[model samples]
Target chain A: MNYRIVTNNPSVKEVYKDIIFVNGTFLDVLINVRDLVHKGHELISHPLGSSIRTMYSPYRSIIVRNKTNEINKDHIEVIENSIYSYKNTMQRRKPDAVNSKDYAMLDLNLLKSALDEFKSIYDY
Target chain B: MKLELGRIYIKDIQFGNKTHVNNGTLIVNSQELIDKLKEDERVKDVKVDIARPGEKVRIIPVKDVIEPRVKIEGKGHGFAGVTSKTEQLGEGKVNVLYGAAVVTVGDIVGFQEGVIDMWGEGAKWTPFSKTCNLVVDITPIEGLQPHNHEAAVRIAGLKAAEYLGEAGRNVEPEEVLTYEIGTHTEEEAKYPDLPKVAYVEMLISQGLLHDGYIYGVNSQNILPTLLHPNEELDNAVISGNCVAACDKITTYQHQNNSVILDLYAQHGKTINFMGVILTPELTTLEGKFRTCDYTVKLCKMLGVDGVIISEEGYGNPDSDLLMICKRLEKENIKTVLITDECSGWDGMSQPLADTAKEAVAVVSTGNVSHVVTLPPADKVVGNAAAIATLAGGWEGSLEADGTIKCELNAVIGATSEIGYHNCTVNLY
Candidate 1:
């Protein structure tokens, strides 16, 4: 499926581009991003015009876990979206992470819709 | 001829020389000689003269009777006079008439005259010359013996219990749980901050819960999306999913247990069906639904006594109903499935009733218990009562009550009196 990254930030565009190219898709890139976010990683950025520059540090420090886990691909996508949403909400409220919500609400609707779509295609 | 008690007198005494006795003379009275020697030849021309108290009479030839050589027959025969006019001697001993030498206990002796008195004089009597032996014969009488199925069931149950514990837990049995998910309807109502809520009630009334645990899964809140970011949500989803999966597995295990019990109970086991039913609402997506054969086979495998299916509000028959009947018949399982529409009556459809009749007929012919059609939901109790009446007797009358009390009464009464030896109403 074709994926696109939409943001007004010129500096963050380079970071999103690098992730998309390296992971081949927004979903694949989000998996690494979510793990970093869960482990207390922070994104540093500066505003350019009306947008802010966002940087994604490489996940060189995150341990490589067992590769044979059977968690559904769709579940991974939801966790990724929740991570992004959490970071975005924190950035919108404050320039620095002085206070943060303990956990972000996962978008169940999006995940369910995606699942229903997948089921339709597979006819399962 | 008779002799004194101390004197030795021999008549018809065969020596090793094999000389036959001929004419002989006795020193006893003529009447005594005639009475002692019933054989005509023994006394035909023999003269018996009474001698002095213990004197012995000399055997002098009457005319030159060859000195009356003392030749005697080896065996002796005499007619013991009849007593009650009945042929007492020949009553059953028909083979005793053969002249076989047989020694018998008796007090009288023909050799002694005064030792044993003669009751009558000149009374003619015939004696059997050849020895006769008495023999008794016997013979035995044959018929049908019936077998006890209850005893068989008990023995099987005990043996099964030894090899297999109560629920066949030693080893995994086969899956007996067959279930059908009803067609999903539109959301009845939605909760304000919650994802659209749907009411999903399984249509499992068609199958039995005989020996298995049934788990209903409702993962309304633990959607996959909610599993992310929140540990609590994730935990809930994991727990619910585990329960759902485990319940399915356990149901299958118990289904197998029932089959083992049934094998012990009925001697045969088979799979009949395990599939879904097609309803009118599902017609648009007929191809989307699986067949009802699986459910039928599962029911048969588990030895389900009956199945109850809730009919859709519309008049269309549930496909599973017919499938259950046919498959149960094929596997020799007694089945009774009910539809919701027929709920007002005791789960009985003319078709279902007919099928039950046919199944019962087939099983009965093979010495197996017959199957009875359980009326649909509406007729369950009433039909049971009707069945009770037909069975007759006090037990049947009590069973007509259609209550737990009735079940107990019927069991106790039937088993005690008529020896009913199949599954009873109280067993379930």
Candidate 2:
């Protein structure tokens, strides 16, 4: 069970030692996810969450598994596109003020849903 | 499956002594209806109001919009399994109060709630503005979890629509719309020469404020499944999502799905309309792969020659949309997609979050980031200030002169990915 959680979610950071903690907005966290993909860590969850308004939230957490094989070009493309989308959305409407606890809670909930499915796949 | 809709056209609505439709006007017993919704223990209070087309009214921080309908010869009462439990749906008769809607407004989930204006420049952006909206504003009990808050309001909205729908149970409809599709094999044989067409409707099944329900079940937990479009059109499916207001398919949109209805219009004449493939836009990578693969597999199994796919929300589901399209095209199944864009307010950025060379036939349903200015309403139905926290609204979006400026993203149905909207793209 080797994985990493790239996140600005402080709750995930406090509990998970494998977290690559970020202190910026959702777009910044996505850029960090892109950097990991470039370093060959495959995505465990989609860089984008189930939310169409994910870019509106300042908090985010993405799951990934340790590199197993060669760099997956598709993962890189997905992350780059996600970053592009985030930038476009932010230009229109910026993320909620930092410490908007409700938005953070929502981001945590999204991570929890992804982690529930991730546990079943990564453990096997 | 064959379902007949008896539509009783409603042009005006007013609080009256009883609830009934009288010559195109819907009269509601305000106190009785408000009392009924308050019976739900999760709700602390209720406010009922009416906003008609061309009125100077603004409804804000809305949750869902549903058309009022009641079972005439249907197995289930109205919302099957939800409002009342009974046998399956899609083969029964239901009465629809045409041109009228029940709009739920609240701050349950906050950021994703939408706005609806009944007059002026804002009215041109959303379809709901054209309908005579019966607005219900509910407040949840203190300290309720976000999930409970969402459900309390969602179910309350459905119940409100069902309550009002009962008034049309026996009214004589202005017209009847019949949707009948035989089993896949039977249809294939009857229209042997016509192209076999199917519809793929992607639902945002993320939990909490983002979810769509099929027959009283959260779609996120289900796999890709086939359906008779009549089941959805008859109100078997519902929207419980608080996604971007511009693109979130309301329960009203589900009952009158433009894609499903338009396909029925071209049924035997142009194509052998198969049915709808219900797929979930889940939150995890594993679920995305599972559902997208399973969707195309079902289409391939049905021997589908052409397909129309519609997405519910944007961002992550953009990945799911392209994955399904890429797979269907690889199988030689002609594919067409309906989706909205997040290309910024200026429309300069890339439209979709993902892309496939195979998605050649695409339909862009307006830009969600397109900005609009709504004039102040003589009366506001819900909290107008709540927009500042909305996904598309920023601080100062509300002007001192009561002129509010916001993106189309804050306006409900302004960018319906289901093609249930007025915005269109013109090639120059």
Candidate 3:
């Protein structure tokens, strides 16, 4: 029933303690996290380059999220401009029911808020 | 193979000077029937009781229910492997005591035995309530182990059914229903345009209290194999299971399998009923994977377009159900699964322990954990206090006033996975 940190993010270690940490890049954590989950271990995926995928287990629950909001301040203007341009292009075309929203321009705060709520419910 | 089933409807049963069917009434010579069952050395004593459709009676700790059938023609008679000598069944002239069943009760084997109410609200949930039940209460010799006790009761029920079936040997049947499935090539040629469909029936074979028998052979020892659908109707398979009463497939269900009958009803005109595949539900992961792989392999070998899968027990078997469905869909074979859910008492828990995206079409039987209250019957057949330890019951399930408050798990065939009953689950 151990919930291990499967990332090298310094922020994760600061928040959690006494858990096995997988000191590796975010890509490494993504590739081997499923195996850990299969063994009844929960993984807290690094927020970098990840997507929201919640998998439930009786012993533990894995919370996966991307940390795009942690991007360097120098690239903020570029990322903002690219997101606005994509949103404007998507709005000009007819909206399909399944893809009505421009996911590329999603609000990053939503991810943080969701993570906090999941943590409060899952941290037992 | 073809089978001609002669139905002799029985309306009432009572003890008499001799055993015979007269004017829709079954007259049983109680002394003769008792003597026949006492022949088994393991049986210490035998007592017989009759429970009619509307009687205020309750039979508890029920082990198995069997329909009486006598084979008039063909290679073998009665239950192929257990009650009768070993032979390939399915093609024969058989007479069925259509409206009567032999209900066996005795010492408890596992916490999985059930209760059958003859009348009132509780009677509606169990199919055995509607039949004229010849309740057989068996007592084994001193120090008899659980294994032998189960076998003794199982064989006694079959023997009694076989003995009663002899009465219809010379009498004319009220109606005759014939079932036939031609050779593989002949059937394929007859229904060339219709889709070919197969049935996968999972049996509990966990040994000890949990097991099933095919032609008297322990099913846990075999791989997936093909069986003629008609053979099952003639007692090719028997139940040795002691799982939850609600979902376990009894010998009666195996003889009158609704899924096979439903599929056979649509054969030729709408679909080509290929055959049935019998697979065992093992305990270990490797055993499960091996059997499941063999099941899909057999289905592929048959080259069927669609298949219907039915599960016997719950929990661990749910994984096997999903695994088989996932493999079958990956091979492009359309599949529909029949299973009972384990939703909690509030009906808020997940229906199954496992799920697969490929299992899109499913027939959900009622939840096993749903609670029900039953008023006391005027007469209790077996040990009434045994309900306290039943799988779906707790320590205080039985009330002082004789009314019982327990989950559907304590009732036999309440959530039959073979679609034997009308109970189903719907989201509110």
Candidate 4:
């Protein structure tokens, strides 16, 4: 089963033209992937039926493959490190990329912090 | 001259859209009213308030009247814009242009109120009109004189010489005169076969040959020589304190302080003394006379028959240059000015050129011996040496390297041609 990812951000469109889903994992199938991620975007998911369960936990972490009930800190750190390295590379490639106003996918910590702040503002 | 007062009469007048009158009964002596009437082209004639009762009306030409007008143009702008997350939106933009017009007092132009209109996307509205007036009057002035050719040539020559002198070279008179009362024995001994006019012309031309009078050195250093010619003269038999006396003999047999005097004596000519040295090399200003005073002292010391100085690049030389010319005039020293590198401030060059021209005119009119200027270097078309040659009024190749390469043709071109016109191309 396969899914796709798309973003409306012009900066994202400029870099990541498309995304690909292979097996159970999603991969950014785009040229200049770093630039697309650095510009930012809203993350949305589409899943193949019965193959995976997608759940956004209270901690703002996106869960996939229900068989792994426990969250692995090392795996989360690897993803975070990869995102940070991609952003750094994008910055070096195009200094003006950061100045662009664009939506982008949020990592667990950033997503959690933003959701927390929103909840506090709403007194929820 | 007869006292002729100009007459004025209104040519035409128009009062709003009601009436266009060739002749009107609104009699008045006000120049302001006359100017306004003149502006109205519809008015063919205006009545002037004469002292006499019935014949108070007088007709005047509109062209003869003078008028003034003012026109202005201005613009202002206001703008706003917004965007929402629900949908994509394009930013808004705005721009405006406006101006004003003025009619001359007596111009007789059509009067109309100007209107401004504003209309655009996401913009506000405002409409308005501006009314302006024009004025006119009458003025009579004098005309100028016709151009003088010989005077122009003399001025050009004087300017050229002055430029060269300022650049630091010893220059000579543009013209020379000689009175020969020699014995027949001397003529027979020298060249009895030569024609009198020919010989005299040759001698005078050589003696009068005045070109390249630039002070190669600064004038201040040359001052000591001027003040003490006798002490500086060594084995120079014909050396004299007076420049004129030294001009009688040719050949300097000495190498003392009076090198300039000896050079003049040997050459039977005058040497231009620049009075003070001023160059990038001498960083200090202590030894230099004020530029103006130095010019005057140089003219006096060198027994300047004719003096030329540039008014370009230098500041107000009027008082100093004029005073020197006056002083020289009293002692019968001719003075003229050349201008280059005009100072845009005060229109100094044009005025100085005018004054130099006037000076030449006065001397020529008085039948006094005048100083002529040399043709200037064609800076655009020639090398440095060629330019210097032109500046010095000398015939030679003045190369960019500052070398004065003389040819036989150049030497023979002018028999009395002196080497002082030679340009030194300082390679360093």
Candidate 5:
């Protein structure tokens, strides 16, 4: 359960000490996760974790295996496929919601669930 | 386990001096119910309103819808673990407010929350439109976290139902339906000739507003497990999911799961109903493989001839559904998947995130992305403008004439994966 949170939601910055905060859309967060996966960090949680409709929410937070090593093919496949599906589903529409904070909180809370398990496993 | 549900059909609802039921009408003391919900400090204010079958009222930003039931003979009341102490359900007599629903309406937490119109074209889509709805509009105290906001609305709906359910405790039901199922061994012995069929109910347990509850424990914390069908009907599993409005399994849906009921109907007649396997759709790929594999193993151990696997919400979970289906087919085990599609507005997009050659027998509840237009209602509850930000809705979805143009995803239960909706796909 070793993981690191990658998010654009400023809400998580105060909570998690380590996070790759990318100031971008939901797609931007997934792309950031992809960049991590390419650099040897495997994804611990699905990039599509909190939602299946990737383009629907304005914010997204992903958890990735923090330890870097040889490339994990499975992680790459998942992230690439996720990015493709996301781009396909969204049809180039920008991330949106009635209120940005509402979507941010939704993403933050879901990330917290995986963080709970990660904390227990990492024993921090 | 044997449970008898006494149904008292409610014909109407009215605000009265005291909360009670008379004849077929459900009378509520608004202040009393509001007071009960406000006891939770997270909830700042509560408003109780009535919307009947053909009213010109529209309830927007709807959260959870719960059925009101009073346990006259059960060990514990319904909504165990949350509204009441942890207790075993599914083995007692409970009185139900058959045609009434407690609908919670409030701030839209995300791209979730939906609309429930009482009449016109909009009414045809949501099953809640047919019930005598006791709309509970809750406003959380300012500065409440989004997670707590969801909880406040969720608990208020459950509490309102609990308080209203008390009125039915004394009223004699019009019909008493009994659901009795013995142990798998006992049933197998008696109905050895029938095809052994079991139900695999895949619940959303990703995270945050994306999880279901088993006796109030987050589904995210549990592995795939087995449950007597009665446990679901009697409130062993509950919905805290705030995903897509069209397909998310509401707490009400768990209480009146159509798949469980349909399986029970054919039990011993067409098939020997073994039991239900509750599988959690997790967020990790590893978790998905583990749950999917473990689920099929349970079905194999039961020696089930066939299984009806129903999914909650779409997308990543679609992969989980197919993984289990693929493995079951590999074992020569029969599986019929029940799900909704996310096909584009043109109905030309791929039906699911993943598919298997073994997924031959699949029942489509409806397409979540299908577009629909709902004419405005005379009276609107909650916020009408909330639809613009909903998953299936856009910034200009709410028009000048109060008309709304959006996908079926914004309409609650329009595409229920559990088969409790009005959606159908006719073969061309």
Candidate 6:
């Protein structure tokens, strides 16, 4: 899928338009792109002029991090592992066969891990 | 402002020859109600039914629930602006048909209408399950849009409540409750030592099917404003939004607002109850900033020491709640927030769209996306199949049998943000 970031910061948008080598989930890319824009890097709106060009899942989750507090590589690995496990579990289930409500509860263990890092950081 | 409520407890409801209150029972002439609602050309037909507590009945796609009330004295009548003339309310001798409610149900207005189960496990989730409900199912004219259909159904419910409230006028009440609140200066002089607390209510005003009306005006079209708690208790504000049912503030909850009542209970003793501030949750970013800033400014202007902010819908409106809280805490004003969550069925998602450290003290009114299964009812009022398209429900939610499997969002008042019900969320 083609993922593009449209930002209010014109300088960031101008510099990031030509850059391409991206491989990540739509939510993952949005969070990283938003962080980049917040860092004062030059930015501009996408050519399509959409905040989100394309996304795999309609249910989008945006995780906002506190830039003042840095997270180590180990913490990133834990979160990534959790995401992978959650995705794998979801893929194994037949989404068309079950309703969204029922689908949400298919793998509570995986869901908990997927949200562990966010919950720890936010103190929820 | 001072108001007197004469409560006539209705132990049962029956369809009989006449519409009146007798021996703790409310008798209604269903045909009369149908004729009254049919007067509106926008509505094609009206069906009235009854669902009593502990009955094997299910009411789906419920829109609004209203308590019946009649103004016997004072300035204005019950539902002053809409059902009656636009007059001052809350300082009147009103008669209430306590333990009874006017519940509106019909075709899907939006993907947010809920279900009401009168018995079994589902009964514990919603307050309306305990009331003697006079369900009014209205069908709009052919080709009517959802927005217009919502308006027609809302008016029909209010009209039905006003009609039923009339039955209590001549009959003597079993109990009477009085409420009186003085002006700001009067309260300050009377309770100089008590902490002054105010209530800020946020209304959903996204547009067409999602909106709240105050005195017949859409709240989104106006700025943050002040209101006496009495005005709300007297039905000055009406809920017209089609937000997810669990969190939606129905018209009944507005009249018997739990927060206002509890605060009133502690008025002269624990705290000096200040007036209420009604704020709107707009859809646009600019509108949100404008409204949130104006709300905090009003709180500061009120010179309140503590405030309780209650949110209406979830998702985008969560930002407005935090924004208001951030500003209020900056002004050193103590605050407590009441809201429901959409933390997914597993309760693993974030409870809110935005978060602020200043929002330390909060009340969680259960999770809207929590999954539940309801047994089949012996009899179902309105279309049970309507659950499939509900916000908290999805395709195949209604089984071949009468059983229903859906999210709490499809249940009416399951997670009332006003603290009307006792449901809450606790981390395991």
How many backbone clashes does every candidate have? Answer: 43, 0, 3, 54, 0, 10
> Residue B242 lDDT in model 5?
62
Please list all clashing residue pairs in model 2, or write none if there are none. Answer: none
| lDDT by residue for model 5 (B1-428), tens | 99999999999999999889988999999998988898999988888788999999988888889999999996777588889898888899999999999998877464555788899888889999999999999989999877788778887888888899999999999999999999988998889899999999999887767778898888888878899999899878877876668888888999999999999999989999999999999877777888999999999999999999999887678778989999999999999999987777777777676667899999999877777788878888887666555423345666788677777777889989999978976555
Best by DockQ: 2
Span of 10 residues, lowest total lDDT, candidate 1 chain B: B62-71
Residues A1-124 of candidate 6 have per-residue lDDT tens digits of 1223322222333334523322443335444544443443322211110000011122222222334334344224323433443342232122222232222221121122223422333344
Ranking by TM-score: 2, 5, 6, 3, 4, 1
What's the C-alpha lDDT at position A4 in model 1? 27
Worst 10 residues of 3 chain B by lDDT: B387-396
Model 2 Cα lDDT, one tens digit per residue, B287-338: 8999999999999998989999999888889999999999999999999999
lDDT of 6 by residue, B1-428 (tens): 99888999999999998999999999999999899999999999888999999999989878889999898887766577777789977787889999999999876432334789999989999999999999999988998755677789999999999999999999899899988998999999999999999999999875555678998787867898899998898889999864457887999999999999999999999999998899987654455677889988888888899999999876557767888999899999999999987666787776665567999999999987677888888988987656555422244556777567766766888989998997999988
* DockQ for all models: 0.00, 0.60, 0.02, 0.00, 0.41, 0.04
- Per-residue alpha-carbon lDDT of candidate 4 for residues A62-122, written as tens digits (9 for 90 to 100): 2121122345443343234333332322221221122122112222222233233223333
What interface RMSD do all candidates show, one decimal each?
A: 36.9, 2.2, 22.6, 42.8, 2.8, 14.3
Q: Supply the DockQ value of model 2.
A: 0.60
TM-scores of chain B alone in all candidate structures, in the order given: 0.18, 0.97, 0.97, 0.19, 0.97, 0.97
Candidate 6 Cα lDDT to native: 0.72
Q: After superposition, how far is residue B290 of candidate 6 from its true place, in Å?
A: 1.3
Query: By DockQ thresholds, what CAPRI class is model 2?
Result: medium
Q: How many backbone clashes does candidate 5 have?
A: 0
Model 2 chain B is weakest, by summed lDDT over 10 consecutive residues, at: B384-393
Q: Which of candidates 4 and 5 reaches a greater lDDT?
A: 5
Off by over 4 Å in 2: A14-18, A50-52, B390-396
TM-score of 6: 0.79
For candidate 1, lDDT tens digit of each residue in B266-303? 21122212211221111101211222454444444433
